[model samples]
Target: MKSKIKAAFNPRTWWPKAKDGMHNMSPLVAFFLLNLFLVWIKTYINYLVNFNLGVTGPIQNFLLVLNPIPTAIMLLSIGLYFRGKLSYWLIWIFNLIQSLWLFANILYYREFTDFLSFGIMGSGSATGNNLGKSIAAIIHPTDYLVFLDLVIILVFLLLRKIKIDRKGIQKRYAILTILLGLILVFVDFGIANVDRDGLLDRSFDNNYIVKYLGLNEYALFNANQTYQQSNTRKKAGPKDLQKIQQFVKENHSPANVSYYGTEKGKNVFVIHLESFQQFLIDYKVDGQEVTPNLNAFYHDQHTKSFDNFYNQVGQGKTSDAEMMQENSLFGLNSGSAMVKYGASNTFESMPGILGQMGYTSAAFHGDVATFWNRNNTYKSFGYNYFFSKEFYPNANKPSYNVGYGLKDKIFLKDTAQYLQQLPQPFYAKLITVTNHYPYDLDKENISFPATKTGDNTVDGYVQTAHYLDQAFGELMDYLKKAGLYDNSMFVLYGDHFGISENHQPAIAQLLGKDKVTDYDLGEFQKVPFMIHSSDLDGGIDHTYGGEIDMMPTLLDLLGVPTNNMTIFGHDLLSAQNPQIVVFRKGGWVTPKYMKYNNHYYDTQTGEELYLSKDKELAKEAKANDAYADKVLSDSDKVITGDLLRFDKRTDFHKVNKKNYDYSKKATLKALKRSQETNPSSVLAKNDGHSTTDEYTTDAPEYSSSSK
Candidate 1:
C-alpha cells in the first residue's frame, strides 16, 4: 500500500509514456493544450496586476480564477475544423497572436492601469508614438513567461521530437470541444450570477466583465456592444427621441425661484480640480491647513458650497466628470464616453447652450488635447477655442510639467492670455493639474510639508492640494485684475477621489476615524463642488449632488430652460430636486440612507441595516433603485441609440461637427474668425489685443509671451 502511494505520487514514474496508445498526444491536441496553458498563465498575470476584482468569497474567487479557460478553449476550437498542417499552423498562429495580445495589454495595463478599450485601439495612431517610447518601462521580467509554451513548442518541432500530424480531429471532436467550452462558460456564468445577481444584463463595468470573463471575452463583448449601439443608432427614429424627451420632462425638477437665473448673463468660469477630494478642504495636518485658499473660498460669502457632493465618475474619471458637468448626461458604464462615442454623439452642452446666448466658449488645459480624446469631444461640445498644451508657454520644458501636464500655476498663468482673448460672457473651463495621482512636487513648490500619517501618498496629497489652492488663488487674482471676477460665475469642483482604498487606512487615521470602514471609504469619495457669483447668497449646503447635476444646476442659474434636452440630473439647488445621488458603481446615497451593492446603511451614522428585515426601508430602497436604474437605462438608450439625431422640435440644435477643428492652427483660426464675426468680442474691442498680457506670476517657469 505504501509502495502504491509512493508510485502514484512520483511524477517521473507516473508520467504518461509516448509509447502508450491513449497517453500520446496528436499535434492538434498538443497545440490546443499549449494554447490553453498560455491563456491560463495570462489570466494569472492579469489577476495579479488588476486588484479591483473585490472578490468576497471562494465562489467569486473561483469564478475569476477559472474565467480564462473557456475563452481559450472557444478561441482554439476553430482549429479543430481545419485539416492537416493548416490546422496545426493555424492553431500555432492563433496562440502566438493571443500571447502577443495578452503581453501588449499587460504593458498597457501597467501604465494606464486600465483595460485596453476599443476607443484606445481605434485611436492608437494618435497615441502610439508616446506609448511606444515608454514600452520599456512597462515590461516586467516575468512578463516573458507568456511565451514559454510557444518557445517550448517551437524547440520541440525544430528538434523533430514532436512531429506535425497530418490528420485533424473529426467533426465529432470539434463539436465536443465546442460543447465543452460552452459548458465551461455556462459554469462560469452560474458562479458569477450567484455571486453578483444580474451579472450579464447589468454588469456595466468593464473590469467586472473582465474579472468574470477573460480579456478575449471582454473584447468580444465590448465589440458587440459597440456594433449594437451603432446598429441601434442607425435604426433609431423620431419616436425614440420623443420618448426620451418625455421621460426627461416628467422627471425634471423645477428650479428654485430664488436661485433661478441668479447668475444669468455672467461669464462662466469652471475650474476642474484634478484628483481633489472634499476631505482636503479645511483639513489640517499638524495644525497646518492643507488648502488654505480653497478653504477660504469654500467659506466665502459668494460661494455656494456642497460638502456632500460626490464625484460620479467611472473609468474615464476626469473626462467622465467633464462630460457629465457639460452635458447633464451620465457617462457610459464602461470606457470613456468621450473616447467611445464623442465623435458621433450629439450634446446639448453648456458651451452650445451658452453659445446661443452670445457667449463664445473655450477650454484651457495644459495637456495635449489628444489625451482622453478631448480634442474631438470638446469640438462636439461646441467650444470655439481649445487652448491645449501647444498654446501654453514653456510647454516643451519638462520642469514646467508633472504627471499629466503643466503645473497648475504655470498653466493658469500661461492660459490667462488666451482666456482674456475670448469674447465676453465667455464660458471657459480651466482644468488644473499638479494635484493628480502620483502626487509629487518640487521641493521649492511644496508649501505644506509631508504629514505624519506614515503614508507618503497621503502626505504628497496634502502638499499638492495646498499647491493647487495657491494656484487657484492666482487665477482669482488674475480674474479680479482683468475685471472678469465680478461679472463671471465661477464653479470649483474636484474631479474625483485622489486617495484610493490602498491609501484609505492612512487617510482614515488622518481623518480621525478609528478604522477604515466601508462607510469611511464612501465618505472619502466626496469631492468639493462650489458655485460662486458675487451677488448670489452663499452658504454651505449639505445637499447630495454629483457631476451629473452640475450642468442642470448651472443652466438653471443661467436661465436656460432644459425642457428640450434629455437631462438625467436636476438643478441641485432646487428644493424639488431629487436628493438621491447614484454612483457609477451600483451605490447610491439619499438623505436618509446609503445603498451600496443592495446593502443599506443609515445616512448619518453609517450603521448597517438589513434590507430583508426592514419592510418600510426595503420598499423605499427598492423604489430608489428602480428609479436610478431607469434613469441610467434611459440615458444609455439615448446615447447608445443616438436619439438626438431624430429631434426636430427641441431647442437643442444639432451640432455640425465639421464646423469645428482641434488642430493647434484651429485656435488661431477661431480667434481670427471670432474677431471678424463678433466685432464687439473682448479681443476685437481690445484692439486685437489680449488683456491677459498684463498678467504676471511668480511661477519659475512663467513666461510673458502670448505666442
Candidate 2:
C-alpha cells in the first residue's frame, strides 16, 4: 500500500523519466511543446500582418506577441492524454487546426478587417454557399505559409527524422502545463487592462480585444459573448423592453411635415447597389466618367440624393447595412446579427410593418438563398416572396455567374419578368452583385477603361462599376416600358464601401491625394443614397446620415409614425434628427466634427483637433461622443437580447415562418394565385403578356439560358 501511494505521486511512474530539466521531457511532452511553438509563431505573424489591430504603442506591441502563448498551451495540451502514436498524431491534428483557424481569419480580414466569431460557426448554413471560389479569390500565395509547419512535421515523420512517441504523459505534468498557461493568461490580462481600461467589459471593437490579448483569446471571448447573447435572449420577457421603449420615445425623430405620407401606397423599389461607393458618382478618369449613367440619375430632376450619406456597417458589411435599412437597428457589435439571430430574433422590419397595409414584400438576389443565410432570414423579415438563384435559369453557369453571383446585366434582364408578376404596391428589393470585391469582368464586357492607380484591387473597380451602371440603365428602361416607373418610388443606395482601408495607397492615387488620413477615411465611408419618384420635387439633400436612417425616412414619407417602435434611427428629412452619423466602431462623423480612432478631426478642413487648445469644440465633441455611444450600446442590447420580440404596446404577431415558402414552384404558384384574386400586377395590368422582352442588354455573354 505504501509503494502504491509513492508511485501515484511519482512522475516517473506514469511518464518515461529520461533526465532532469532540459532533457527531462518525455516524447509526449516534447511533442506538445513543439506544436504549441509552431502555432504561436504562425498566430503572431498573422496578427501582425493580417489582423489590423492598430498597434499604437510599445505595450500593445508587446502584448500582441505574447497573447497567443497561453491559448497555444491550453489547446495543444488536450492531445497529451492519448498514448503511443495516437498522441503524436493528435498533437499534429491540433497544430493543423490552429493553423487552419489562423488562415481562415486571414481570409476574413481581407474583406472585413475583422476576426471570426462563434456565430459564423454556430450557424452551419453560413458555409453552404459557393465559399470555395470566394476563398480562392481572396487568398494570397503567402497565406499558404500557415500550413508550412504541418507539412514539415509530416515530412519529418516520413523521413524517420521524428519518432512517434510511444509513451503517454503523466496527468500531473499535463495539469501543471495547463496551470502554467493559466497563470500566463492572467498576467497577460492584467497587462492588457493596464494598457486599456475596461479592456474586457466595455471594448465593443473586436480589434481592441485582439490588440490587447490575441486572436485565439478573442475567439474564446467571442464564444462566451455569443453564449451570453443567446442566454440573454432566452431569458428576455415583455418587462425587459421598458428601457428600450423609453429610450426610443426620448430619441425618436418626428416626421417631416412637408414629405410625410406624400408617397403613400406607391410601389417601393429598393435597388441594392452592392460594393458601390459614392466617389464613383461623376468621378471622371482622364475626363471620362466612370459611372456616367448613375451620375445622370443622381442629378435627375426627380431624384432626392444625399451626398453625405455614409454606410454604417462593421464586420457584417453588406448584411449589416441591410439590417440597418430594414429594421432601423444597428448590428451586433461582435458578429452579424443577420447571420446570427436573423432566423430566430423578432424584428419590427420594413416588410412586417408594410405587410399590415397590404404590401406584398419580396426580395430578388442573384446569389443562392443561403449565401448569407438569407433563406431563413427573409422569413423572419415577413417577406411574402424571395426570388433567389434557383429562380434565375443560368445563374449557375460560369458565364452568368462570377465569384459572388450572377452577372448584373443578365440578372437585371432576367428579373424584369418576375417584377411584372408581383402584386401592386409590392416592396421589392433587387440586389446587384457584378461590382463586388475582386471585381472580375470578362474582356468582352469591359466597356470602360480601368484606372491606372498602380493598385490591382482598385484598377478593375471602374470597369465593373461601369458595367453595373449599364445594367442599371437597362433595368430602368424596362421599368419605364413596363409602365412600372412613374407610379413607383425608387430607393437606390450603395451597400458598403467598395475599397477597404487595405488598399489605401491605391485609393489615394485614385483621389489624387498623397496619403490618406483617418479623417479622409472617415469621409471615404460615404455611399450614394438617392430617393427618386417621377413628378416629386427633389434635389441633392446634403444630410449627414447613415443606413440606420433608412427605415425612418421611408416610413415618414409613407405617412407612418414610429411611436411604439423600438428604433435608433432619425428620419433624414426631419429637422429634429441629430445629423451626427455614427459608425459601428465607436466613432462618429458630424458636419462640424469627426471622431475616429479615439481622436477628433475638423470635418470641413480635415485637421486634427487638439482638445487642450480648443475647449469649446472639445465640449461639443464630448457630448456627441456620449450620445453616439449610448445610441450604439442601446441598439446592440436590443439586437443581442431580442428584446423587440417582447414589444408590448401593440398586439402584432411575430412572423410565422411556416407561411413563407421560398421554393420556386411555391413562388410562381403564389404569384399566379394572387393574380386570380387581386389582378393588380404589371402582367395582370397588361392583359397577361410578358414584359421581359423590353429589357435589352449589350452584354457579350447574353444567351437564351440567361434570358
Error of 1 at 185 (Å): 1.5
Give per-residue CA lDDT, model 1, range 256-286, as digits (tens).
8898887888899999999998988888878
- Tell me how candidate 1 scores on lDDT: 0.78
User: What does the lDDT come to for candidate 2?
Assistant: 0.84
lDDT of 2 by residue, 1-707 (tens): 99977866565664566655343667677777788888888888887777767786789889988998987887777777677777778788878887888899899778666777877665546643555655677888999999988998988876868766666766766776677789889999999899778777766778888888887788889989888887887777777688767878998888888899999999999999989998999998778998878898899999999999998987677788899999988877776788888888888889988888889899999988986778988899899999999999988788888768999998988888888989889999999999987888889889889999887778999999999999999888889989999999999999899888777788889888999888888888899999998866789898789999999999898877876778888899999888989888667888888987766889889999977799988898779867877788788778878888777656356778888999999889988988889899999988899888777888878654443
> For each candidate, what TM-score against the reference?
0.85, 0.90
RMSD values for the candidates in order, in angstroms, are 5.9, 3.9
Backbone clashes, each candidate: 0, 0
Most accurate candidate by lDDT: 2
In model 1, which regions exceed 4 Å deviation? 1-38, 41-49, 57-62, 76-114, 125-175, 190-198, 451-459, 502-515, 597-600, 650-652, 657-694, 702-707
True-structure RMSD for candidate 1: 5.9
Give candidate 1's TM-score. 0.85
